[model samples]
Target: MKKLILPFLCIFLLVSCKNETKQGDSNSNELGTAVKDTVIVEVPKVPIEKTIKEIKEALTAKGFKTFEYVDETTKDTILMQQYFMAFLKRSAIKMQNEEESERLQKLHMEHLSKMHELGYADISGPFGDDGDISGVTIYNVPTLKMADSLAKSDPMVQAGRLEIEIHPWWAAKGIGLR
Candidate 1:
């Protein structure tokens, strides 16, 4: 009985030792590579102001509404512009290369004409709806009245083909006009 007990203890110790070694090897294999922590930094934003005193004066002279100004600022104008240019380039490519989609180019040209007629110098990118692409235009016009009038009376706006949003320079910056 003593001899049998001694043999059983030795077998148990050997099996446990083998399992411990296997576990250690597995853990070391998992630790082969060192992990790195990444840090991201964000920069402060700067505001851009556009004064449309001339555009506003022109609108007022045309007997449009009284001028009220709303300032406009966007966090990522460059990104927005890039997106706009990409859309334009893609649309142009599609129009030139694809025969079945001429209407898109036509609608875009019409919208561009409407924007140009209003003396809008800045385009806020294109918004698409039901296969139609419409763009927002920003004018450095002088008065809110003129902006409102142009927004309301423009052919695109009247036909519900375009949307117009007016913001005074101060309003864009959340500041009050003096």
Candidate 2:
């Protein structure tokens, strides 16, 4: 008889414990809204192509022309924290002669092309509208000193026919060959 009573009490205890857990799970808030164990949140994802298109749209709206090139390895987008920007502007000093100016122009083009080929210059172009600023060049160099050296190496800049203003620029990386 004692053995039977002990087993029954154990069973009763187990049943009572399960019922308490169920009751606790069903408890509601003050407003009578049942609580949920887990909440599902929906998040929207943007494709890389869509993001790039939107960026191009914003740039075009502000009179910026963008160029793109493909990378052979790693298809992931290259986002960079900072870069160097060189602003090419006409200096106050005049060239010695038209021939000298032409010679300097050729040398300048060669220098720019070499930089572009060596993976230093990512983008460079003249301003479409006439302004004090002649053109702009973006470099992937790591330091200001390197960028300054590059600018100073230009024949036009060295000859004082053109002046360069270097500034730290923020840009997205891996857009082009650089």
Best by lDDT: 2
Per-residue lDDT of candidate 1, residues 1-178 (tens digit): 9999999999999999877666664334454533346457976586554445554455458543443433356442221111011121112232233443455446655755675665543443566653434455454455566556654554434444444555553223223346
After superposition, the stretches of candidate 1 with alpha carbons farther than 4 Å from their true spots are 1-108, 114-119, 128-134, 170-178
Q: Write the per-residue lDDT of candidate 2 for residues 1-178, one digit (tens) a residue.
A: 9999999999999999777666664556655556777578977696435556565566556444454444459675443335789999988889479888888889999999999999778888889987889999987676788888998898989999889999988755434553
Per-model clash counts, in order, read 19, 0
In model 2, the runs with Cα more than 4 Å from the true position are 1-78, 176-178
- Report, for every candidate in turn, its global Cα lDDT versus the true structure: 0.47, 0.77
Which candidate number has the best TM-score?
Answer: 2
TM-score of 1: 0.28
Clashes of 2: 0
